[model samples]
Target: MKKIFLVYSFLFSVFIFGQEKSGAKQFWENLQKQCGKSFEGTVTEGATNDTFRDKKLVMHVRNCDEKTIRIPFFVGDDKSRTWVLAYDNDRIQLKHDHRHEDGSEDKVTQYGGTTTNAGSATLQFFPADEETCDLIPNAAANVWWITLDETSFTYNLRRIGSDRLFTVKFDLTKTVGTPAAPWGWKD
Candidate 1:
């Protein structure tokens, strides 16, 4: 009876972990398809910042590895933001890397969240983690997400229990000129 119980437990745990890894792997692969490509985007919704709306936006899948992917997000000429996605076993973490003009880290750099569950291949949600809340108190209720489909890729943010919302949609059907390296880095 004891041997049977041990075998059952081991198999159950393996099954659960395998399920978790599956979704993350699929999502990672989907994003990897855009590696080495640059896409033009627009602020489809959000009224908090007029500057964002007026500027041209671009996203470049600059680097991708088995466990990490870095995407530089350009706003007109401001290349301060890079979205970092990292995978560990079956979960994915999303971090925002903000840098200064001199290749120095910004005050509010490296704020993001980790996945609590295996999200679908086309979409994943990242709620503000403890680090993000500590970095920006008002962002305690923030939730960021990305969605990739046949036609477009969208980066969205919503503040829970508030009216704050921002969404940017990138056209996947076409490619654009690659933007310069983000601040704090050289090509």
Candidate 2:
């Protein structure tokens, strides 16, 4: 009687939550085609005369499929490191692969990504044992927030674990480029 009702209620809640997650994923799917191509910009670290600036940070994003994305990043014409993004059920997952110039894996970094129903996605990088909740212990991590618009995109990053709150923002407007291929419908 009461036990059966409790089980049914739990099942209903699970189903509703699953649908809500699917809705969030669908939003990302809609932009799969347009997310490809290349973006180049400068990346700055630190401040003042000691500040390190890499103007050759090339960001190449490719739409592998409706469920996967690949971004290859290079610093100062180096071509051995890359950041990979692939769909993990309703969310996106990020992987950092460092390699020698000859293409051997030097190190591996694991990162996580999540996208909201709104046109915003976050990529978070941390140690595997670290906890990421806003409350409870408050572990620090490197975070990137990307907000998309029909004609432009905004990228912001925050580096945690420091006494100073270090933040950077890049505002870019879309330029002329070939149209993105249709997902699932085109080759």
Candidate 3:
């Protein structure tokens, strides 16, 4: 009876913790499915300025690996932005890597945060970290999130203390040809 009870307890523990890990793992895998693919997006909300108006917005899953995925975002002909997602320490981290045409890092780059909770298999949230606070004080209260479902992927950002909000959605059911490398990346 003792042996049977111990086995059952061990299995139960594995199921509980495994489910948590699988939730994140599944999300990563779902994203990996888009490797080497490109999709066009539109600013569905919070486009209060001309920055995103009447522009061709594209996101490319340029690089992918077990631990990291690099996605370059292109606005018209500008190739200065990339969104990097990394999995480490049992958490998913989101970072923005910005560069200039000369392949030089921007003054405001590599600012993001890690996942604070076990988000669902199709969604994850990343609140601004200390680095973001130091780099962009006004954006200290940012919360960025990405949601992936069967038909779409949405990238969103909101500042907790202000009315700042940005959201872009891509259609997953259709993919376009991959664009040229971002400003800082080599072919």
- Give the per-residue lDDT digits (tens) of candidate 3, residues 113-183: 89987577899999999999999998889999999988888999999978788899999899988899999
RMSD of each: 4.2, 8.8, 2.2
Top model by TM-score, which number? Answer: 3
Question: For candidate 2, lDDT tens digit of each residue in 1-187?
Answer: 9999999999998888755535335435543645566555444334544232634444555546766665555455565545555566555554555666655565443433454323323332323223333322343455545444444333344556664333322223432332332221133
The TM-score of predicted model 1 comes to 0.87
What lDDT score belongs to each candidate, Candidate 1 first?
Answer: 0.90, 0.46, 0.90
Model 3 lDDT at residue 114: 90
Task: After superposing candidate 2 on the true structure, give the runs of residues whose Cα lies further than 4 Å from its correct spot.
Answer: 1-27, 44-54, 111-140, 151-159, 163-187
